[model samples]
Target: EDKVVQSPLSLVVHEGDTVTLNCSYEVTNFRSLLWYKQEKKAPTFLFMLTSSGIEKKSGRLSSILDKKELFSILNITATQTGDSAIYLCAVVPSGSARQLTFGSGTQLTVLP
Candidate 1:
């Protein structure tokens, strides 16, 4: 079966602190790992990892992939109150299903 799990299901942080979000998965046909940020509307793409140890970063957010361990981590530094949002992880399958199967996300709440 294909499944994804995230740890520290929720987090609360004050502005300027740093946080890390974790996601692990077991998929029969795991092709890609994708991260998203959700705030009411459609989830926004954050990162997509297909190789190990290589990290993808943007602004204050970064992510790393580990294919052997079947896990990924996302880090946020200098967090702002506007950064409060749900971080999601989804698995992309190879060569067939074009849909992403999502994991229950980690809710991050940043206080002003």
Candidate 2:
């Protein structure tokens, strides 16, 4: 069975603090890993990692995939109160099924 594990299930940080979120997975056929941020309603796409060692970044946020290590890390710099949200990590398996295996997610709270 495909499985994903995220560390630091919850975290609290002050505004401007930097945080690192982790996601590790074990799957039969790995295709890609996706990152999402959920604030109020729907989850917004953050990043998608298909290659190893390459970092993806978007103002204040960045993520990298380590295929050899079977893990990925998401980094947020200069966090703000608005950055507080549930960060979700999901892995898409290769093949026709194309089902995504998701972790419980990490809830991040930023205090101003």
Candidate 3:
């Protein structure tokens, strides 16, 4: 069975602080790694990383994939209260039937 694990299930930080979220996985035929931010509503797609060592960034958020190590990391710099949310990590396995296997997620609270 495919498995994904995220560290620091919950974290609390002050506004302007920087945070790094982790995600590791063990699966057969890995395709890509994905990150999402979930607020009160549905999750919003953040990034999809397929290459190792290459980082993808947008605004204060950035993410990188390490296919060799079977892991990925999400970084948020100069965090704000608006960045407080549940960050989700999902992995897609390569095959005829591709599906997303998600981790428990990291709950980040940025205090004002």
Candidate 4:
């Protein structure tokens, strides 16, 4: 069965701390890997990595794709309380909107 899983179920960080969220997966005929950040509303898109070395970044958040290891990592620099959210990792299958295999996600709580 194809699936994605994240480790360190939860993390507590102080303001200004840098944190990393991990996502691992096993799949068949996989198409792409996507990451999302969830607060109160549904998760907002973060990154989609298809190739390695190429990292997508916006301000304090960044991510890298590693198709070799079948996983990806999200990094936040100088974390803020607002950065607290559930980080989700999903697998975009061979077909579009075919439904993604998602991991429960890693909850990040940044203390002020």
Q: Identify the leading candidate in terms of lDDT.
A: 2
- Full-model lDDT for every candidate: 0.93, 0.96, 0.96, 0.91
* Model 4 C-alpha lDDT per residue in residues 34-94, reported as the tens digit of each score: 9999999799999888878799999999999888888899999999999999999998889
Clashing pairs in 3: none
Off by over 4 Å in 4: none
Using Cα atoms with residue i matched to residue i, what is each candidate's TM-score against the true structure?
Answer: 0.96, 0.98, 0.98, 0.94
Task: Give the per-residue lDDT digits (tens) of candidate 2, residues 33-98.
Answer: 999999987999999999999999999999999999999999999999999999999999898976
Of models 1 and 3, which has the larger TM-score?
A: 3
In angstroms, the error of model 2 at 7 is: 1.0
Q: Which stretches of candidate 1 lie over 4 Å from their true place?
A: none
Model 2 has an lDDT value of 0.96
Q: RMSD, each candidate, Å?
A: 0.8, 0.7, 0.7, 1.2
Off by over 4 Å in 3: none
From the highest lDDT down, the ranking of the candidates is 2, 3, 1, 4
- Residue 55 of model 4 has an lDDT of 92
Q: What digit string (tens of lDDT, one per residue) describes model 3 on residues 1-112?
A: 9999998899999999999999999988899999999999799999999999999999999999998889999999999999999999999989886679999999999999
Question: Cα miss at 6, model 1 (Å)?
Answer: 0.8
Clashing pairs in 4: none
> Could you tell me the C-alpha RMSD of candidate 3 in Å?
0.7
**Cα deviation of 21, candidate 2, in Å:** 0.2
